[model samples]
Target: MNGKEALTPREFLRIADFFATNGYRLGPKIGEGTYSKVRIAERSNNGEFLAVKIIDKRIAKKSYVTKFLPRELEIAVLVKHPNVICTYEILHQGELVYIIMDYAERGDLLQLIQTCGGVSEKEAKRMFKEMAEAVKYLHNLGIAHRDLKCENILIMRDKRIALSDFGFSRLYLDQQHGDVTSKTYCGSRAYASPELLRGAPYDPRTNDVWSLGVILFIMICGKMPFDDRNLKLMLKKQMSEGVTVPETVKTQVSSECVRLVYQILDPNTDSRPGVVDILQSDWLN
Candidate 1:
């Protein structure tokens, strides 16, 4: 499809006026989702290309924290990094919120794994490095990406990765660590840490490291380390037996890498290596 078909109803209306005053065309629908939709388009006047993510305004307005879309705008506006999805602009038309951002052709990491049947050792190492660096950067900025997962990690044109979706992120500016106890249980069941499962006091970094280990495990093995029909049983195994990096996976990944994964997946959050340890590992460095 051409550029016109790419623009959203509101974007089309706005662009229609601008085009009446100037010129351009919208391209084709590149991707879409339950909460939003994305498309590629070109500006007629300067031939500039752009990707737009459109969210329903009425729904956004009705969202508890996102009432009037300020929270989402805050997240989109504040987060910017080479390894983070870049939000270009936030536009409002009637009751809709449209966020314009850079488009990554490769989409999310889960799809990437599905295509390749899991990443090779070298590629997984490279991706792990990038993902760790991004996490480090966010932590330094006092941000904890509480909901990190394959679906939240997107692949860019250069094959580099970018972290997305800060809706569940927590910004901790104080140097002092907060209380370890968290009443609310968050994160995917498969990726949830032992502390989260136990409903105990938990630090963000500690839990994040566990989830990271799970991601790396999935990357190498093409499946989760803990596989059980029942969620409770699966978590019990993760807590008690620990996630076993299969023999085949161990062969593909370095011993150091496997060791590091073991270090991170330790059920005891207090004993799990912090971000620094993960970064300084031989596999990463």
Candidate 2:
């Protein structure tokens, strides 16, 4: 099925019925969002587990989902990288939209960080490398994930990372320009780039790099580098003072890691390293 195409309610039901007939079993709910609920499901034929995200069409139509869903589905289906969550199928039934995806048994990075306080530098380096690889793959495909945060990074049972949640992603290319910039200011406040916080037009790719820096910081420090509750103060700090690695973290984390964080989180987007540079950094190597 071409996920990029719009589907009618009747067509959606037909697709859902096909999947049901093909032995997809929806199980207990595993997570929930404003207009969607995620459940564990089993593919009867192979007994493989998957996550089924069911979205309420009624609510989705009134939210950002109405505009982002198509692109989200398209990118999910097209991007196939080891570090990216796999979108197996998309179905619809009446007022509900279903997205079948690979199940990450170990939950997300946020949950792990909250449970264990934080990860060791060695572990954080491995996870960050995987994330950088995934981001490089997306950028190569002319795509940019605007919302790259710890909560959106899933940990697989094998200890690898899978980047998920493409709801705010966008293509950076246009037919005429080949590459373009974005002005949308949508993402977690704490992870947002300085330009985004300032309501200025920004390059989505660099914006993602900033978020990755924030995620890395959280992974090692167990706290946000920027304060989301106080937007004005956070913006001022980000633009003028830049991110500060607490003396405690500085003592624990490697100097290379600290240098990378500062480089990635630079207030001037132009100074921030691209995903490729990050992937090739000595710390990641």
Alpha-carbon local distance difference test for all models:
0.73, 0.85
Return model 1's CA RMSD, one decimal: 4.4
Best TM-score among the predictions, by candidate number: 2
- For each candidate, give its TM-score against the true structure: 0.82, 0.91
For candidate 2, what is the TM-score? 0.91
Q: Across residues 1-285, which tens digit of lDDT does each residue of candidate 1 receive? A: 122344458866774454334333545567664456676656666776666666654443254335324544676678778888888766665654567677777888899888888988889998988888888887777677767889888888899999876655666454476544444466676787877777765677677788899899889889877764677897789877887888977776789989988998998776888888898998888
Question: In candidate 2, what are the lDDT values of residues 242-262, reduced to their tens digit?
Answer: 888999999998999999998
Model 1 TM-score, 2 decimals: 0.82
